[model samples]
Target: MTQLNNVGIIKKANIYFNGKVTSRTVLFPDGTKKTLGIMLPGEYEFSTDLKEEMEIISGKLEYKLSGHDWVTIDGSGIFYVPANESFQLKVHTVADYCCSYLNE
Candidate 1:
């Protein structure tokens, strides 16, 4: 990933998932958005309307893309999810991550 500097006009957003998950959205200057947040230890299923690249910033998580087997990812690791698809994540520890939405 390329370095992003001069991110102008940040807006904070909170996303809730039935009290199980919460993520803070960070808006950048060039219309790119990233969510920096933590995921509690549990199993979660998520559907996305846009393509996303999820990077593990701290801790670890095991995730499975649709029709795929689960794989573990650590800090600095990334996984991609295509648009209109769903994925599952099983977290054993409190995982910190950044989800970047990819604009087409």
Candidate 2:
């Protein structure tokens, strides 16, 4: 997770919730993609097209998947979001994260 080698990054950011959330798309050679982003304190709901592995680099937040209870991720943690579904987040502090999109 320290370095991303041989990858392409999109120049524009994916901005959401009035810029409270922002991320840049990183494209890998194997046709996989990931997003590195920062989240400011806010509540947000997101829909996913591909399965996602979200790794929190720092800060605190709570996430809720469909049919599941809210789970807290403080300091650093990782969570998975299934494809073609939605999830919610309540960010308590500024958080840095990297999300890897899975083809499977």
* Best of the candidates, lDDT: 2
Candidate 1, residue 28: the lDDT equals 83
Decoy 1 TM-score against native: 0.83
What lDDT tens digits, residue by residue, belong to model 2 across residues 6-99? 9999999999888999999999999999999999999999999999999999989999999999999999999999999999999999999999
Which tens-of-lDDT digit does each residue in 1-104 have in candidate 1?
A: 65556665345546566655777777687788888778888899999989999988777789999999999976658889999999999888888788999976
Candidate 2 to truth, TM: 0.96
Instruction: Give each model's clash number.
Output: 0, 0
In candidate 2, stretches whose alpha carbon ends up further than 4 angstroms from where it belongs are none
lDDT of each: 0.81, 0.96
List TM-scores for all candidates, in order: 0.83, 0.96
